[model samples]
Target: MNASPSHQPHPAEWTETQSLLPCVERDLPAGRHQFHKEQLMARIHEDLRTTTRPEPPKRRPNPFLRRTVLLPAAALALAGAVAGGFALSSGDPHGGRTALATGPALTTTVGAADAEGAPRLLDRISLAAADTSTPTPRKGQYIYIESKVASTYTSSVGDKTSVVSEELHPRQVWNSLDGKDGWLIEPGQTGDEGITLASEVVMSGAYDVLATLPTDPDALLRRIYRESDATRDHEVPRDQAAFTAIGDLLTESYPPADVSAALYKAAAKIPGVVAVDDAVDATGRHGVAIAREDGTGERTEWIFDKKTLRFLGERVVVVKAVAGSPFKVGTVVFTSAITQRAVVDANKQVPGGAS
Candidate 1:
């Protein structure tokens, strides 16, 4: 239950979030974030203008820069909406803009999810995670991750209503071991110069904190549930919160091999977790997935490299269609693919310093 919520980045400004400055995917309390999201979503009633909006069904959620999980299912429906929906829709609602192409929101065919295959797949995923190698960020070092992502959300112009998708764009983050100093560069969320990830930095998103967690699956599960209790939305089942929290951890931060393995193994213990054979990450790479549908109308899928079982990224898709809702089944609301992650020596310094 990483309880630090102040320094979190929720999906960029949408209808409800228009007043707040745009940031990346968030991992804050479900009560506040969910309340804000569901309240605004409930207001959607007008039919989407065919000229600007897609037919429906979208995805995204979040990762790398772990923020409170939510969106394009407004974060789950893709950043957990197309970024938590890839964003609550990237950036300002009025412009509905980003470096990604702007037009109709992104949609996709519904991939099949299998409950029976989940556990076995998770087992293999756990082994692969255990064998995976990651650089350790020491003191005076920074954890850097780069992702290609987008968001989906309902928008309006004059009297016309439409769902807009930010063209896919790159999101970069730099976090120090202390979580007190960092920077973020995402077109819709920040300026080209980016913003400091300070003042709001929390231990929850720091690599050092992840290294200290218990590696035993059962014990780790207990720890996650216990920490999540304070922030859990009363409407959400604890199991779902635990699962989403784990998704945020896996997608957004660099975890130790043992801890990563434990997280996967623990995911197997949760009820309702499933597997999808036909899944794709934000990078357009196809692979298997481990997913779960929360109380929200969307499902979150963690994608993996098919051959090596290496984690690629995650996406959110609408599993259940809501009446009059802007999104439909199979809509990819938010999506993110990690193109690079490593231990860098300075804030804002990229891997290989190429970008």
Candidate 2:
């Protein structure tokens, strides 16, 4: 298990937010910016194709390389901090309920039934997004998101026995549209800090970058695939990596209505995409989903409101059972629901209420 991250004071006060919120900072793991940049550049170069000279590659520094080794560890920590509900061999065969050491725990509800296959659904979602009027904020504004997440893991007591554990938590994040400032708030921890915008990773949580993305579905899809390849760890499968890249963009950033619709259309073009109706988010809101199963027994779904066609959340489920795995077939390994999102003028200003 990874140790919890600690909160550190800002080296210097932020003049922009000193009046509204205190500048408490978090220690970002090194190389995070580099990793994001690599992903971004992949997409841009794929489109431009202007460079003929094979420039020397930029290698990660030794200190940052060591930090890169901790990426998986940090993932585990984030998983425990945000995810919840594990599966057991003894639980319901459908895996909606989990069997705890003490008793059976009623957990996630079963996913919704399949809808009009992937193609039709994606088309409708794209049309809806294009028709809707979600606001596009200015560069200095902030986007606030309130959400809940759950993660599942397995722990072995001995070679023969193990237990699956899951934890769920709520989170609030304020992102600067220009990508110069941000803040994260969760149970018992908060961070106020500075961050750089990666021009390459257009889908990353940077509104400025997202604004610059191509509006055409084909062009956008190509960019996403290229970027996914550029920053991928190589351990993940290609299709899965591409799908995850899209998911990250949808979940973490607020894109313009046109761009969002273009992305939906682009996603529909991806092979192996599927649709599910009646999926439930962590908040218990029922919606539809577009999903893809990674070759590794895990399936990721992006859930959306049925009527409004608005994004609701995302979930990860187990499609196959593996020995000693924390997740069983049909088990919901992770879920996150976006409760609220709005554009505000100040870092401390929330959309519907006080920060």
Candidate 3:
């Protein structure tokens, strides 16, 4: 009965049957038949009038991205702070002190006792000791005297030995005894031969000779002392000729004020001078007034022996130059030979001579 029905199937059934056949064949070749099956399925779908489904909207990343980035940044900042704190807390290898917030205060004190009384006493003692120790000729007095100078001199002519002897009269203005009024014998005119020449010389040639009558030796001595004191204070050139004349008569005298001051200044500049004592040259004793200069020559100090107040001596230490060279070339020692004897009578004026 089914075979009889199949011989005369309906048109609809036939079409369905044909569709089923093609689908079976497509199933056998899925890679090649997918497009055709899809076309047919699209046609069926179009015929069915199905509603279209809307697509979901695209989404963006979370808004917390800024916070995410800042988290790591914050971590890095904390790490840097920790490291910096460690560095500051650690002690420095070098010996550097911590900075101070404020500076220290300064203070000073003054008194009349220091400025007037004590200083004066000390000065008096110093002066007295100096006067007694050195043979300084009385000031302002004229004297006839002789000196034996021991010196080695080299001249263009050659080396020679010289003996200098003369009669010296100190004048307020005259510094040397070699001039016309000064008493120095010319070469070959010394001894008895110079007696006639000495007589012929005029007293007018004398320099700084005072014309005061009834010679006041004290006044003359005072004038000399005052001049010498002024010279010492003001730093005037030590008139060598004047000093020599005075020294010849008195034995020793202070260098001019200027020279003494210069020596002080120089001593101060020396690197190692710790103290300076006054110069001294009198009574056959010779030494500087000030004993300064440290042994090492790097620092200096001013020194005065409280008891003696006289400069005894200085100890100098060696110092090397920047280039490691020797700094000092030589050492100089200054000595003096002065006496405390009056060589001439204060009231005795030279015959036919102006005071």
Of the candidates shown, which would achieve the greatest TM-score relative to the real structure? Answer: 1
Q: Put down candidate 3 lDDT per residue, 1-355, tens digits, no spaces.
A: 0000000011111111111100000000111111112233224222211222111111111001101111111111111111110001111233122211211111111111122232343343334432442122254543332111110111121443221111111111111221112222111111211211111121211212212211233343334333333322122222321121122111111222222222233222222222223222211122222222222222111123345443321111122222432223211111111111122223223323453
Residue-level error in angstroms, candidate 1, position 303: 0.4
lDDT of 1 at 263: 86
Residue 256 lDDT in candidate 3:
23
Rate residue 70 of model 1 by lDDT.
19
Residue 202, model 1: lDDT of 41
TM-score of 1: 0.75
Q: What are the root-mean-square deviations of the candidates from the true structure over C-alphas?
A: 10.0, 15.2, 58.5
Instruction: Please identify model 2 stretches exceeding 4 Å from their true place.
Output: 1-116, 156-167, 188-203, 352-355
lDDT of 2 at 144: 66
Model 2: per-residue Cα lDDT at residue 330 = 62
Error of 1 at 176 (Å): 0.3
lDDT of 1 by residue, 1-355 (tens): 1111111111110001111122123212222243223432223211111222332323222233235221112222111112111212212334222333456666777788899999899898888777756656678988776666666765676777777766667777666775546666666444456645443224454667678778999998887787655454568887887787677666556678888888899989999999987776665778788888875677777887677787766777777877787777877766666666677888878766643
Model 3 scores worst on lDDT over the 10 consecutive residues at 1-10
Return the TM-score for each candidate structure: 0.75, 0.65, 0.23
> Candidates 1 and 3: which is better by TM-score?
1
Clashes of 2: 8
TM-score between model 3 and native? 0.23
